[model samples]
Target: MNQSFINTAVLLTAYDPPGPLNCVFFMLTFFLYVFTILANLILILVIYMDSSLHKPMYIFLLNLAVNGLIGCSAVCPNVMDNLLRDAQSISYGGCLLQVLFINVYASSAYAILAVMAYDRYVSICKPLQYHTIVTPSRVKLLLTVVYLIPVTLLSFQVYLTSQLPLCRFVINKLFCDNLSVVKLSCVKSALGDLYGVFIIASLVVLPFFLVLLSYIKILHVSLRASKESQKKALSTCAPHFIVFINFSVSILFSVVYNRHSTVSKYVNHLISAQFIFFPPLLHPLVYGIRTKEIRRSITKIIQRGILAGPL
Candidate 1:
């Protein structure tokens, strides 16, 4: 690519159209984006509007839903637009914004999941102190930190990336991912790579262990409780665990796929989309199926909506 044109905009490909199925695949992508957004929105509003759900667990659930919404919005619309059109390009400024949103939301999710695990532990292990520990004000503070840490850390990442001079402008993937954007730089910054590893470890590894620790304590306490209590704890925490595993696998695939560029470009494209596309839909689905309270609330709301509609 011409060096002079690098500053103008970067051409991003959705997936190297591997076959003659571009129209059908893009259509599936568009509908999936729409469905994911709608399902997560429903989940969020159910948690918000239902006064019965105004507790610590549901509060964190709300945060998760919001993360789903913001994260999907960050990357999906751009992907959909690119897939529908003949050309796929994002301006330099817009690309930076995409990188910022994608990282911030993705990072915040780790924090929120950790918080949710802690919420579960307190509720199951220290029932008496659960209310005192996870108060509305405290939850507000936790969410503030969740979003704050990512934005602060990723801003530095973007700053380091911005400092690099780019002579290459083609991004091989669908959206402006942090690693992908950084990879385009003519000279790779050692400091940027170190910071990337640090923040990733901080965001992902630490939180996963924290969640694991909370669950361990929860399991111990749950075992000591009565059979009914054990079942109840399992019912509540199982869904969160499922979501955690689902998301962890997706993040792992993205990390592995990016690190190993020997993977086919079309294959990388599909794998990258899995992380951005699947979790939001999966979060609501897992919670809705596994959590008794959420299921009842959803049913009540849907029945009301249907009853209130025109005959």
Candidate 2:
């Protein structure tokens, strides 16, 4: 292979070569992509159309659905395109752009979950002051921080990555990630290493810690409250907890598997794809089924559609 081609386009050799199996994989993924998009879109539209859900909690849910859509869009189309092509590769610029959106999607996910945790904490622990603290302006500021932090931090990460000269062209994964791109650098970058550590600590560790703290406080308060209150709190926080745990565990597996992949290539691919597959598909479903208000809204909409059918 030519060095220019290697440098200009990184081959993703993680996937199986194009064949009947690959075609089947493509069809499965295509359906998943469609469902993921429709689910998130319906979640967003439901929240938007229902004035009753205009409150802070549902607003945060809407933000999450939008972020899921961004994350899903960043990877799915590219994956499908590559699956159909003989050479599964991505251009240098395109790889960086995918890295940017994916990193934003990931970092924004934890940040948004952290914000949601705090929202739950305030609502459960301080009901009287919930409206006062989580006011409309406050929610706007929080959402801004959710995207702003990820974009600023991950953009710097991608920029530093882009500056490195590549001595490697093939990525051993299904998609381009920052770590994979940085590993392709010909020389070691001390500054990039330090910044990478800083980003992991600030973006991943901190948000998880905040979520833990919020839940602890919520638990403490719930223990002291009546059974009815406890039930209410559990119902309210269950979906968020489920969503957070599922995503965090998937990401943890991906990181661990990438670092020490003793498993077969197919297993590694599936493990890595979990972060892309499960969260976007599951988040809206979890919230829609578990949350009474959203579930009720969706039911009403479906019923109305059924009743309004040609007669």
Best by TM-score: 2
lDDT of 1 by residue, 1-311 (tens): 23343347788855544344766777787888888888888888999988899988888888888888888888877776776666788887678778888888778888999999998888888889887888889999998888888899988888777778786788877888877777787897989889989997898889999999999899889888899999899888899999998998998898787667576667777786688889988998889888889989988999988999976
Candidate 1: regions farther than 4 A off: 1-7, 14-20, 261-265, 306-311
lDDT (Cα) of model 2: 0.91
Error of model 1, residue 241, in angstroms: 0.5
Off by over 4 Å in 2: 1-7
In order of appearance, the predictions have TM-scores of 0.92, 0.96
Q: Which clashing pairs does model 2 show? A: none
Q: What lDDT score is found at residue 137 in candidate 1?
A: 94
Worst 10 residues of 2 by lDDT: 1-10
Q: Summing lDDT over every window of 10 consecutive residues in candidate 1, give the lowest-scoring window.
A: 1-10
Cα deviation of 50 in candidate 1 (Å)?
1.1
lDDT of 2 by residue, 87-123 (tens): 9999978898899999889889999999999999999
Q: How close is candidate 1 to the true structure, as a TM-score?
A: 0.92
